[model samples]
Target: MPVYHQPRKRIILLIITALALLLIARLSYLQLVEKKYSRLADANAVFKKIIYPGRGLILDRHNRSILGNDILYDLMVTPSAVRNVDTAYLCRILQIDKTEFNSRIADAVRKNGKVRPSVFAGLLPAAVHSRLQEGMYLLQPGFELVPRPVRSYPYRAAANILGYIGEISPGMLKMERYADYQSGDYIGLAGLEKTYERVLMGQRGIQYIVKDNLNRPQGSLENGAYDTAAIAGKNLQLSLDIELQVLGEQLMHNKTGSIVAIDPATGGVLAMVSGPSFDPNLLTGTERTKNISQLLADSSRPFLNRGIQATYQPGSAMKPLTALAALDEGVITPAFGYPCRGGYFSCGRRIGCLHSDAGHADNLRLAMSHSCNAYFLHLYRLMVDSDKWGGVKKGHARWREYMASFGLGHRLGVDIPGEHPGIVADTAALNREYHGAWNSCSELYVGMGQGKVAVTPMQMANAMCIIANRGYYYTPHFVDHIDHADDTLLRRFREKHVVAHVSDTAYHSVVYGMEDVVAHGTGKGARIDGIAVCGKTGTAQNRGRVNGVVTDLKDHSVFVAFAPRDNPRIAIAVIVENAGTGALFAVPIANLMMEKYLRDSIPLAKRPMVERMMK
Candidate 1:
């Protein structure tokens, strides 16, 4: 159309032609000269085998190995690659029948399609693996022997605490949290294994290996240029003394209960045992499925960590906290005493005392020594019915608040999973349960640690730590620190949590009574010869609703203690189910465990006692 337009159009065409030529040249160079790039075509030539790192170790306080890592073999199969193979010889080498072999092949095809490799058989026996490995060439591209890492328990103790690992489930594969995981990946299933999984599961690596014509792996492809190094997981150092754990397990044999010990200063758990436990190794090898099924069928519930999962009434063992609450509420003084005529009447209900002697309930310290039920019941009444709070409801609410500060009716933030927070009834809940017409006398059983209030053994041991530390405690934990890592992951446990402040005299009064209990009173069975132990014994009611009516079974024996009195090193809780009294089984076992840790040995005279308790 115009002369200026012609010039502009020519210039645009030139620029476009030059750009097209440059792109072509660049492509030619990349195809013909650039050899530095990764050879994607070589992917079929070089197999990318996954190199699994050994999981992190679980170690005791002394750095001794608690769990062992053993390498096991699995037979991986590609159903599509199994063409023209001798089925009889293959099954014979794998020590399986034709039916079982066919079943596995069909299952593999269903799970992973025909091309992808899936485990045909897992945790192979050594004899079977050796035979299959030798005859593997005849089996051709169908099968490969892959090594897998498995756990072993060296101590054969703390089965429920160490836990186990298993294959990733289909449900887990769909979750965004496990997006990186594949179907065959093994994951920690329970206990410490489950809690510290991410840290313990080391990074996976890749290796490139070239195969010969016969289909056997040769050396690394291209001198391992494309390989990545696998990193072994970081080690976790626990606060547990393995010896102490073993002893607790031994003493708890033939019984159904738990023993929990904690270092009072740091809140680190020293030992935790759930009784009737199976050997942890039973869940490790080829027998895992069968052993797990058998363990699941046991009525005693060997898998349950009773220390943190099961709740029970603290019974008379709760009197110390009751005394502290009363003193803090100004309902009772340290010097206050109660009069007892073998028992006391409240709301026309008779509450029995541990002792029926004169002067046993004359002073607060003596009341505690004798576990005088009437004295603590009187205190619970006064605190809840005080005129300062102006009503029963408000006073009880304040009391509940104090218990919360003491770490009751709540989870203590233990590193392990499935901790029970226990039941600590608030006034509103009580009001509804009682139809809004209840008084302080209606729940007096709570004063001596019964009725609706309950606690796990772990909580009871932590409570002992509060009294031992005088007012504050650290959150009880099993792993003290991760070896070679910064303390950032464990900062929360290092914090000091101070319960509501009562006067120092109040703590002193409670401690005095507990000490006297071991010195000459009801809990003399808990006394260690050279160490001064402050302890409280409990005979907790195990009740049930049978056909809508109340029924009481044999009581649970419980004992909570901290030793060496002045600077307590360890605080412990022991419970024996269906035991008659705290003095019968609970107290003696706690004392022996204390001696083992503190004194390092039972004396010649105490050896008989240790043997008797072990039985």
Candidate 2:
């Protein structure tokens, strides 16, 4: 107790002095030592403008520019700076009413603070921009005309392949991935544009500028010392052949269907055409919103990318896969034969056959050549009921595995978006549908590519690539390469995927049969001179409502083919909805595509067929 009381008073005084000194130091640093806070306080007189880099161009296989940029202008405004301006004259120049102008200004102020610039009118055409620029001086410090880049489709074909871009939405701006984007920034809306958006959208640079008291931008601060240069987006080289794509589109015009062509050696997509398609130009410029409304309201669904989005029963076009599965499982040999008697009368139901001649399907080759429904039905039954699998479920499971390996009954993992994984019923699903009462005959219609089986046109084309390659195929993709880009984006497409380790004997037998189908059977309509075309025809049965009742409608015509029989270059798949037989419409289209791609032009002899199909 000697000196404790006296030391307590000194300790309290020392603590108080330390606190006062700390507060004084902070105040001195803020008010006299630092200038950053002063600059921030005067931020209303500073402008940070964005310098948007031009988007990369899209080129075809032949180095032709399919998509390029065009010069456009955006009318940006700062609400707080808008004074002594003639609102009526500005509205007339922008072709807007006074109410709309006021609303736009209010929106701009809400998005960006009253002091910052926001887009009032965007993507204006050159003609309109020129007219606006002539009178922009009257608007002065409040408004500025800034150059913006917009996509222009020179070819006007492949609208579904080359998608459009639109301004970023409020929701998108909130997403973590799009944090770098501003409210008025453009984004890819669909097709290739959407798929390769990161590669196509260039980086934006920011430049902080000094401004006068009136909010007019002077030169950059510190001679652009803090500015970061924008990097232009990498250009993409597509595997598509614009000529072939145009031809496919022309052939499919006025029809409801799709055509997909793939390069056998590389799995590169050469052409993809979905019918009822609109010109790509329709989705560009100032008319985009109105055209989109009309497209959405149309019943034909021009927005649907049928090649990758539409799935339907593949019919006998799937016969080769069924045969390969059976042969791979050792359930059938190359000489496996099933004589047709007008129908497959096994399992109590009469599944009809395409032909009833005694020797039509006496062997696998003749069976495939004739597209004999009885033969494939028997093969499917045998594969799913074989002693090797022990039960129907096990055999069906094994068969489904084989189909999946061939990229059937699933999404082929194409580069494009909106790809649907086509349906393939598993044992569990079959159990659910038939209450565990299913058998080989319970779903025998699947043997002939019917009954719950579906495939996208892209998958159909890739399957043909598998057959053409004899063992393996790369994933079907549109972009062949990206300029000034890393290989990380293309590593997946470069990997070869094997369907199975089936023997050369099995593939040879199937290829021979496919060739015979075109040379001596139902696929004769697809035969090309000097080029051995291997093809299969299919008529997929479908149902529709008629007068408030479900009824049988015209079958969908389908065809799959590959040319040269040895060094195949092209594989094609065609589907025409509500058409007669595959040989009637689909086969001719396939033949024309193959000839055009392989021989560089359709021969004079095939011109009649082309004209007929165009009708």
List runs of model 2 lying over 4 Å from the truth: 1-42
> Candidate 2 residues 1-615, lDDT tens each?
668788998899999999999999999999999987776656776687888888999999999999999878888898888998877778887789989998999999889878788999887877888888888878876888888888888888999999899999999999999988888889998988999999999999788888887777788888999888877788999999998998898888889999999998998999999998898888878888999999999999999999999998999999998898888888889988876887888878787877877888888999999888988988999999999778999999988898899897777778889999999889989999999998888887888899878999999999999999998999999999999988898889999998788778889989999999999988998888788999999999878899999999999999999988999999999999999899889998998898888878888987888788777
lDDT of 1 by residue, 1-615 (tens): 988899899999999999999999988887888754435344334555777789999999888999869998988887766766777888777678988989999999898876567888888878888888888877777787889888989999878788899888999999999998886788989988998888888988888888655445678988998899888888899999999999899898899988999999999999998887778999997889999999899998888889899999999988899999999888888889887877879669787876788888888899998998898889999999999999999989988888888889999999888899999899888988999999998898899999889999999999999999999999999998987789987999999998888789999999989999999987899887778999999999999788999899899999999997999999999999989789999999999889988987777888887788788
lDDT of model 2, residue 328: 83
- Backbone atom clashes (below 3 Å) for every candidate: 0, 0
Report, for every candidate in turn, its global Cα lDDT versus the true structure. Answer: 0.88, 0.89
C-alpha TM-score for every candidate: 0.91, 0.94
Q: What C-alpha RMSD separates each model from the true structure? A: 5.2, 4.0
What are the clashing pairs of model 2? Answer: none
